[model samples]
Target: MGIISPGFFGRRRRDVPGLPPGQHLTEDFPVLSAGPTPRIREDEWEFTIRTEAGGAHRWSWEEFITLPQEDVTVDIHCVTSWSKLGTGWRGVSLDTLLDSVESTAEYSMAHSYGGYTTNVPVADLRDGKAWIVHQFDGSALAAEHGGPARLLIPHLYFWKSAKWVRGLELLRHDAPGFWESNGYHLHGDPWREERYW
Candidate 1:
């Protein structure tokens, strides 16, 4: 709907020489606790979607590219105090992926390989806030920025949209993620400034 604000670090104007017209630089943002740093060889990276009713689907890097795509601008608010403005990202909507599968889970948790998990309501994924992003600023995502594939849920706190995400686990109830279980907020709606709860 609206790509609201910049990310955790600081916002900068797009003034590259010959990059895409509206493309922005998302690399300056910081990666909090990079999480043992998952290494992704071209053949090793994968994205999986698991349903509450026990159905699961996995996508390789190439396969992930075959899905429908859209470019969206969203406001990403990090738990820390920093907001970049008007970041452009391209990817498939989480709802589009869910529609391809059948699930009964009321809530879901995003799972990353290095013990990272972020909980979110199933309805939220259906809303425009969530996406399985592959491109940032018209460029293939760089590894440090969660390249190949990463979750983009801007409405919630940035931690909910994990970097280097490997899969999504649909749950019937809420579960705290790596930061959430520690000290981050449960329902990290930036609109309410619910950075933590």
Candidate 2:
């Protein structure tokens, strides 16, 4: 993506700087979810990031909007052979959410209201690497595509960037997530084609 910000990890490792290996680019953003869509009202939404030892930061839908926000253009690669390029999103950076929390956790387990969880290295979320997005293409995100808010970590396979995100639990050690525990790779990198363990 030409709009990729400086110091993005995916850019640092590649020369071609386009789609990852084994993924075909697509313009249409597909709607994929593990189960039925959950309709969440804005007044009832909440997001939290907590450390295993107990420090936590939480925001309601209203509070979340008051924090700093930015627009991002990214190329997203899904594990199912589809890559969507030049996707636009608006949200708060994960860096902001973890700013006040004092913790030394190296891993994070993203928890969704629907009981879905995905794990990722905490380092991957800092310094503009990840976001919790509520808007897509300048419009409010649809319920089918994870409304209210969803984690967006474009560097990894889309599954790692979970939908319907509600809270994040920082961990001292690495752990497999839903798909990872069920056969998907622990660390999914589309370029390496790490779709499964």
Candidate 3:
């Protein structure tokens, strides 16, 4: 047999900075889908945003891809105690998505294609706070990891990122989504140890 490779026997800790409380560093991004991955082709994909006032903004795959895009690098912390640092992504900023719309709504709910929903503060998703990412690490995001597009709000726990993201709904009040309704923290802040009901 060939000689064994060095550093292949176990996980080594990286010098990741600003990790939230109770989180361990991980170099590899883990897969943690809650349901079957939906395979959406570029032609069949669409994104919509519905405001509480009943106005809807929609985008088709072709149109969505044509929008201005940006690249971002951030550290993401999952509620499960794993944090991945310096993850790279390319997508439209939430600010870009909300630019034309004007509203006093205080909360935004991200709705995913597979019926996954996660709510967050409207402010948290604006001012360069979040993104709707279609590519990660220079490749199209894989299905299991929220391919086609996913919301990336790094400041909050990973669950707020909303994998397989499809749209956003604006509301005057906070509304809990899947995990939130099921006992996960309504506003998950890793550094604050906000992980449960």
Q: Higher-TM-score candidate among 1 and 3? A: 3
Alpha-carbon lDDT of model 1: 0.76
What TM-score would you give candidate 1 relative to the actual structure?
0.81
Q: List model 1 lDDT by residue over 113-174, tens digit each.
A: 67678888888889676899978889988777776678998867678878788889988778
Error (Å) of candidate 3 at residue 93 is 0.4
Q: What lDDT, from 0 to 1, does candidate 2 have?
A: 0.90
Minimum summed lDDT over a 10-residue window in model 3 is located at 7-16
Candidate 3 structure quality by residue, lDDT tens digits, 10-51: 454564568877788877889887889988887888899899
Off by over 4 Å in 2: 1-17
* Overall lDDT per candidate, in order of appearance: 0.76, 0.90, 0.89
User: C-alpha displacement of 39 in model 2, angstroms?
Assistant: 1.0
The residue-by-residue lDDT of candidate 2 on 1-197, one tens digit each, is: 36777766652344335878777766788987888988888899999889889877899999999999989999999999888888999999999999978898999999997898999999989999999999999999888888878999999999998888999999999999899898999989888899988
Ranking by TM-score: 3, 2, 1
Q: Which scores better on TM-score, 2 or 3? A: 3
Which candidate would rank higher by TM-score, 1 or 2?
Answer: 2
Model 1 RMSD, rounded to 1 decimal: 8.0
Best by TM-score: 3
lDDT of 1 at 156: 70
